[model samples]
Target: MDRSKQLYEQDATDWQRGMYEDIKTTFRAPIVNWYFRSLTANEPAFTRYLWGQLKPLFQTRAFGRYAVSYRDTVLSAIEDGPADLPRYRRADTALRPAEWRELRGQLATFDVVAPRLALTFAVCDRAMHGDLPDANPEGAPSTAPLPPWLDRDRGQSVTMLEAGDVPGDLSETVDEIRAFHGLEEGLPSIYRCLAQWPGYLEPAWTDLEPILESEAFERGCRDADAVVDGHLEELPYTPRLSPNDLAEQGFDDETIDDIQHYVRAFNRGAVSKVLQTIVTYAATLDAGGERSL
Candidate 1:
């Protein structure tokens, strides 16, 4: 076998092994388990639903690799510093007040909205390719066509985010994409509680009375096409929630403030650690490195 092919195979094998071990030991068995337990104690159904949602994320090699690659890309962008970063559209000007309010309402329903969309993408992508490892799924799949919702000039007026558009609220963007995929409704109440509580324990009883009583919200929840289209129509230009708004919506203000305070701390620490390990490995590649390449 060619030396380059041998090296590539070795690297792929090592990556797969390491990723599987890390996910099973660190992510699936412990962190995710604990997260679900804490967030979904009351909602057994929601807990089960979330596990179902995460099954593909845990099982798929493509998703595992994508997580690491996306982290690296973000770290690299951070290292490049603010001046070199691409200009993102200002959320304040991009969306009007009524539009922002609508987006917020959608976001309030995000727990159900996001995971469904992710599932749709996963299913569609897998169906198209027969569960084969994506040729280049580190970020977005280059071969897979953009979803129908994102097509430009389609009379839907959806915002098409460029590859580098870094929004202020990463979570919200994720939720919006989930909503676009028709996977965003009829999620179990426990899943809803998990969305509300996240790492913390949820309240024993959810006030489902409002949701059950509201004809409009219930109808919106039921109409999958309308919900998807509504989100798509507003995507072309929507405002991210401000920090105060985020706090009001139950995210930890102190944590967000602290992270904002030290924007590059993780890049300088965790990311640099990974890069240093890579450099050390590279240094050991003697003169034959060039020939091998």
Candidate 2:
């Protein structure tokens, strides 16, 4: 798979553009994530089919509650536990009011998408591995109707600095991010976006880096994974992403292998770490009342 490839929204075909719009609407965010974009680039038909199969997992009230729970899990751990770091606030930086607002809005987009991505990875990872439950577990919760306005109108489209374009002043921070995520080259999209506000991203990473390395943060990631595992049976629609299923849907063997490899790569460690990092960074902005809860 061409991991670096991305199908930008402006470059999408009409059908792909429509799908992107539907994705933005369904995600309740203004931007499509790299996962969707990369999949679209690989094969628009499979991406469309995969999205349709996965959409129901995010639509139910149970999933909304899961999103909140996921947020609270990370925040409460940081706020009440041994992360033991002082919360960084908007005033901690010299950002102008407008810049702070834009920062907050962009961070909010990451915050909202974090949990959804976690769940998506969970479903896709398990499905790709044949680890999904064959039937609803005995005591799973109902796939309740989704509550309206859960994180609606909260976040703006996320914009990121290119990995190569990250300012030299933030090289240490960028290096730390790349090292921690085990990337030999290029930074994650979240860090690239955070790089846009070096003053904020620098201190935030300084404080967050230790916690991300801590036992508490590790526990939180495991807990986050369990939250999704615990809900596998309750998903309104299980993803039809197994190799056979994809092949049956006209995906070639190479595409199926690539999809599986990609899903597993994102699912294993990267997505949860990114998810938690986004949540922790966004929580810091709200710590001093600069952002709404």
Candidate 3:
């Protein structure tokens, strides 16, 4: 982690609280992603510029339609053993029906949109390079209910547990999640949620490594990214801001561009990383969330 960038959640600023809430609501996720967090940690205004362009596009009904369609396609497109998903899911009991529904919906949203997010980042990156992404995104999905589990009161993501913070038996699972995923930032937040159920976490660690390492999973992710690429038109984007625009706001071009490129790259690949993680976790929930913590 760069000292200049706030890579961890503890480094968040006050403004980020509001942004995190809004972004979570918009994205239907349990927490804000590290990519967005690091960007804001470095420069708060970047959130406005970066997400402003992206937010509108994502908010559209059309984008939602494509997202839903793409998710369905990718889920089936992969050859990763669906046969194994049943087994991985067999060991759970924490969440009730609505909770299970909430968890899987949130996980699926990330999984289904994984490829498009990668493309969107590429589009943003090209704009920085003076190649614009198309402002036109089409399609409409009816307004759907978001997962109630993301609610701060009734349901919250269990605070992410550090390896040392976990019970001795569960520590290795955290290590493998980091080692196998090759994440520079250790485990993503969702894994900690699994830590609450040791039985689920134990088997889940075994299930994920092979599936993520498989040819079918890689092919599915690539195909999903391409599908979104085909559906999109690359239009010119100019940093979503300029030297003057940033300077007037008490920032500089170099920092803004640096943040843009860094975050764009972060976002580009984040979908698959998150998808690989969440779906593996969701298998248990999908199998009906049967075990108690």
Model 1 has an lDDT value of: 0.28
Model 3 C-alpha lDDT versus the unseen true structure:
0.53
What range of 10 consecutive residues in model 1 has the weakest lDDT sum?
284-293
Q: Write the per-residue lDDT of candidate 3 for residues 248-290, one digit (tens) a residue.
A: 6677677866755674555464535665345344444552221
Q: What is the lDDT of residue 285 in candidate 1?
A: 17
- Model 3 Cα shift for residue 95 (angstroms): 9.1
Regions of candidate 2 where Cα sits further than 4 Å from its true position:
135-141, 287-293
Q: Model 2 over residues 2-70: C-alpha lDDT tens digits?
A: 878989998987889999999888888888888889989977788889888888777877777678888
Deviation of model 2 at 2, angstroms: 0.8
Q: Enumerate clash totals for all models, in the order shown.
A: 1, 1, 12
Off by over 4 Å in 3: 1-17, 79-84, 87-123, 136-158, 234-251, 268-271, 287-293
The regions of model 1 sitting more than 4 angstroms off are 1-29, 33-35, 82-293
- 1 or 3, greater by TM-score: 3
All candidates' lDDT scores? 0.28, 0.78, 0.53
Measured by TM-score, how close is model 1 to the native structure?
Answer: 0.23
Instruction: Output the better candidate (1/3) by lDDT.
Output: 3
lDDT of 1 by residue, 1-293 (tens): 11111111123244333433443332322112122233233333332333443344423433333333322332243333322222212252255555544333322232212223323333322222233232323333322322222211211111223323433334453354234323343322223322332211111112222322244323323332233222222221122223543355455655445323232332222222222212111111110011110
